[model samples]
Target: MKKKYVRLISRAAVWSPRFGGLAFLILLFSILLQRFSVIDVTVFMILIIISACCVVVSLFFAVKALYSLWVYGALGGMKALRGIIYSLTTAIPLVLFWGFWFTLPALHDVSTDIQRPPTFFRTARPSDALPLKSVLIEQAALQMSQWPEMSGRRYDGSPDRIRESVLNVLAAYDWPVIAQKKFKGEEDELYIETVAKSFYLGFISDIVIRLIDEGDTTFVDMRSASRYLPRDFGANAAFIIDFMEALDTEIALLPLSQDEK
Candidate 1:
C-alpha cells in the first residue's frame, strides 16, 4: 500500500491540466511553469523544444548586442528614446536567459527509467539465443492479436538488447525488408509498429547498440527516442529490460567492451 501510494503520488505529480491542457492559456502556463518546474510530459516534447528555442533566442540577442557597440553604435544610438530602448533591450536577454535557468531543476531531472546508456553485446545468430521478434509477435498476437514485424536481422547483440531482438526477428524471416540494412559501421535497429483506428500501437524503443568492431548509430539516439520509452509514452519500466532479457536467452550476446553497467 505504501508503494502504491508512492507510485500514485509520483504519477499525480504530473497528472494535471498542465499535461492534458489543450487551451492556449493552459499550454502557455504549462510551458512557463516547465521553464522552472519538472513537468509530466505526455505529448510530443513541447516543453524541451520550447525552452531550448527560448534559450537560444535569448542567447542570440544577448550575443548580438555585444557587437552593436561597433556596428550600430550600441544599438540605442543617439535616438530620442535611447534610454528606454537601451533598458528594454538589456532586459530582453536577461528575461530569456533566466527563463531557461529557472527551469533547469525540473528539466534536468529525468526518470531513472531513461537515464542509462546503451550497453554492447555481440551476437552471431537469432536461434543462438531467443528469437526476439517472434516472442513479441507471439505475445502481441496472443495478447493483442497483432503481428509484430522486424526492421532488420543482422544478429549482433548489444547491452541495449533492443537491436538484438530486431536482428533476431529479421533473421527468422526470408521476407524482403523495407527498412535500411547494416552498413560498414552502422548496426540495425528494431521497431515494432501496429496502427489501429482507436489509437496507434507501436514499440518505439531505440538505442545505439554498439556492435563489436561495428559502430555508428548502432541504436536510435535518445534525444528523440522518448517517443517510445516511458518518458514520452509512459510505458512499463521493465519493457526494455524484458526485451533485452528475451534477446539474451534466445540470441547470442557477446560484449564488445565492458558493459555500461
Candidate 2:
C-alpha cells in the first residue's frame, strides 16, 4: 500500500478559506449591526478592525499556499484560490475606506460659513456639539481652499420663499427635520435643523440650514457634522454640496410672479 502524503501548505490552504469566510461574515455582520443601530459606533469600529486583520492574515496564508503549490508541487490550489477570493470580498470596501481616509481632509464638521457656522438647535449629546470657534483659523482656511464652492448661496427670493424651497429639497432627500424656526422679523433668521443618514452605513450627521433675510434676497448657509467620528472622510462636505445643488434646482423650478417676470 502506498503511503498517503499531505503537504503543510495544503493543510494551510484548506484552513485559509475558512478563516477568510469567517472574516467576511464578521465584516458583513458588523456593518449590518451598525446600520440597524443595534451596536454603537465604537463597537462597530472595533469589529471592523478585527475583521480587517483577519482578512489580512487569511490572504497572507492563501498567497503562501499558492506559492508553495507553484514552486514545490503542493496540493489544495482550489482551496487557496477560494481563500484569496473570500479575502478580497471584504478587502475591497476596506481599501476604499482607507483610500478616502488618506485622500480627504480630516474634518468631521463642515460648513458654508466656517467663521459663523449655523448652530444646531439640539445636539444628540452635549459632547457631540463642538463649537466652531474651537477649530483653528488655519483649518478654516484649508476648508475654504479645498471647497471653494461651499460658500453660502444668495437667492433672488424672499426668506420665506427660500425656506419653503429648502424644506422641499430636504424632504426630497429624506433628511428628517428635528427642529425648525421660522423667520418672524428682520432680526430673526429662518433656521432648520435636520439629521442625515448615510445610504450604506447609516452613519448619522447633524445638519443645520439658516436663511437670512436680505431685503429682496435670501442668504442660505448650511453646516453638517458627524456624530461620532473625528474624521468624516469628506462625507459632510459632499452632503452639503449635494443638498445645495438640490435646493438650487428646487428654487429654479418655482414659478415666477407676474411682477418678477
Candidate 3:
C-alpha cells in the first residue's frame, strides 16, 4: 500500500510541471487575446478560471510529493526529493504570480489628493476617474492616515521649468502623451494627460499631471487610474511613486538658480 501511494505521488510530481506549463500558456494566451480585443470578458474570465484550476492542481501535486517524502522518511531515496523539487520549479512562479495581488488593496483609484484629484482631459473618462465617490468615514480616515505623503509637491521653480521636468519624466517612461495644454490666466496651469500600459494584460491606465504656478512655487498634482478594472493592484500608487522619484532625480540633476542656491 505504501509503495503504491509513493508511486502515485511520484507520478503526480512528474506531471506537475506540465500542469504548471499549461496554466502559464493559458495566462499568456488570455493576455494576448485581451490585448488585441479578441476576447470578451466572459472568455477572459473562463481563461482565468481554467488557469487557476491548473495552478492549484499543480501545487497540490507538488505538495503531495513533498509530503510523501516526509511520510516515508529517507527510504524513498533521492527520487522523491527530485520529484518534489521538479514540481516546485514550475509551480512556484505561478503561485507567487497570483499570490502577489492578495497583498494589494481592492480599491483601484489612488490619487495624490483624494479631495481634489487631477482631472482628465479625455471626452469619455472611465467612470472611476477623478472625484471619488464618498466612502465611509472610517475608510476615508484610514486612507488619510495611510497615504499622507501621497499629496502633491510644491517646488521652487517657474511653471514652465516644472512642466518641462514633468514632461521629461513622463517621456522617459515611454508613456503615451495623450494631451498637453497650457492655460494662461493670472497664473498658468499646465495639464498633461498620458496613457500607461500594463505588462500583464496590456491594459490601459490613464494618468494626468497638473502644474499650477503660484509665483514662487509650482504645485504639482498627479493622478493615475485604470480604465477597465475597479482594482489596480497598487499600480496607481506605484506609478506615482516612480514618477515622483524620477522627477526628483531629474530636478536634482539640474543646476540651481543663484537665488535658489
Task: Give each model a TM-score.
Answer: 0.23, 0.87, 0.68
Q: Model 2: number of clashes?
A: 0
TM-score of 3: 0.68
Which runs of model 3 end up more than 4 angstroms from their true locations?
Answer: 1-21, 31-45, 56-94, 123-148, 183-187, 199-201, 256-261
Which 10 consecutive residues of model 2 have the lowest summed lDDT? Answer: 128-137
Query: Which regions of candidate 2 fall more than 4 Å away from where they truly are?
Result: 1-9, 67-74, 126-136, 182-186, 258-261
In terms of lDDT, the best-performing candidate is 2
* Local accuracy by lDDT, each model: 0.33, 0.83, 0.70
What is the TM-score of candidate 2?
Answer: 0.87
Candidate ordering by lDDT (highest first): 2, 3, 1
- The Cα error of candidate 2 at residue 87, in Å, is 1.2
lDDT tens string, model 3, 185-225? 88778889997866666556778898999998889888777
RMSD, one per candidate, in order: 22.3, 2.8, 6.1
lDDT by residue (1-261, candidate 1, tens digit) is: 355422111212122222222222333555555433344333324543553344344334444444454454453222213322333444454465457445422111111123332321322222322222211222222222211221212344342454544456434432222233333324343333211110122323222222322232233321112222232222222333333445445655544534443
- Candidate 3 accuracy as lDDT: 0.70
Q: Which regions in candidate 1 have their CA more than 4 angstroms from the true location?
A: 1-166, 169-178, 183-210, 214-224, 228-230, 233-237, 252-261
